[model samples]
Target: MKYRFVIILLSILILSSCEFSQKRYKPDWDKWKNYKWILNKNVRNNINSGFTLYKKNANFNLIRYNENNQLVIWEFKHHNYVSIDSINFFENIDLSNFILYPGQTFNKEDILETSVRINSDLDIDLHLNLNSDSKIYEYINKDKVKGIIGKVSQMSLSDETGYHQVLFDFPIRSYNVATLFFKRDDSFFILILFPDDGLVKDKLKDLNLPELNE
Candidate 1:
């Protein structure tokens, strides 16, 4: 018996991949947690004719709004594969790095990629690592950090001009980070920060994290 048909074809390919992942995703425990979206209308007229972020002092809220293949199928059901989902920042975030909230960080992996080249057509660190639930931090750089290579910008509002942000600070080094990217009608809107330790850089130079409101 030639290895008995390779052990019955690897046990029918692991039971047909667990019966096609329990029939094309089944664990919709109300999509776990943190969700509430409704933009449609070309993503609410492209964030309502774009460019209007002057909030300056925190209250950042994007609350896990997915749509990059439904956050890659909700990271295949994240928030609790073994527990981890506590970002809590949408109710007067009094200060810190100002505002760069979204989520995803591992504390460090020695990333230093900054040549600035992300004007659209999504890649966003491969969909922000399929929306990580690792939850290392998200207040903009500092402590046991080694992650700051992210760069992307193309928050276009149709032939844009004026408001364009792609924040970063590389002055003699203090390990701080901030990144933002937005796009609609094709899905993509990202905000990330978690490499801080630069002591809120003079209140993030008087902040401006507000965006999206129509």
Candidate 2:
């Protein structure tokens, strides 16, 4: 009886520790506002998705252009890195070698490399998933060899600078997507590009952006 009681207490303690650790690593969104934003001209022109990327150390601030040509800003803080090689078809090729062509037909393998990283650890992914269908799973099936296929209507690329940026139009009806591939770091940073619809556009009205005079 004493041993059972002791075991229960130990289990509770372990659970508590895990909970605390998760909370500790949870991103502090409030503090993210304080990071300085430096304009990245290379990203602005090369991948002309109407969004400009600003660097803040390992983090980035994205200024997205809505359908109306208005700008909305979003900040992305890197939480953790997931290797692209872990995904099936991507295992043999480096992500940088892949070029995205707009209006091109791509199978599950093409989107998998980017979608997995987006879905794996970000709250933004959850928000998108709730609003749209499970497009990610739509591509996966019994034959790991044969995957789902879809078309990419909007896409952009930039390789001039050291960092490679590729923007893939999200399968979701209303969202845009941009991903940064860093050669030196061997990692990718995903940025959610909120569509310039009335719902999201109104909320970003108060965001202070850098001067466009330059």
Scored by TM-score, the top model is: 2
Q: Candidate 2 on 138-161: residue-level lDDT in tens?
A: 232221111222222333332223
Cα-based lDDT at residue 55, candidate 2: 32
lDDT of each: 0.25, 0.30
- For candidate 1, write residues 48-131 as lDDT tens digits: 111111111111222122121111111211112111111111211112221222211111232221111123111212212101
Stretches of candidate 1 off by over 4 Å are: 10-16, 19-214
Model 2, residue 32: C-alpha shift (Å): 2.2
Root-mean-square deviation per candidate: 17.7, 15.1
After superposing candidate 2, which stretches have Cα over 4 Å from the reference?
Answer: 2-7, 10-16, 19-24, 27-30, 33-173, 179-188, 197-214
After the best TM-score superposition of candidate 1, give how far the Cα of residue 37 lies from its true spot, in angstroms.
4.1
* Clashing residue pairs, backbone N/CA/C < 3 A, model 1: 113-149, 140-196, 141-195, 141-196, 141-197, 142-195, 142-196, 142-197
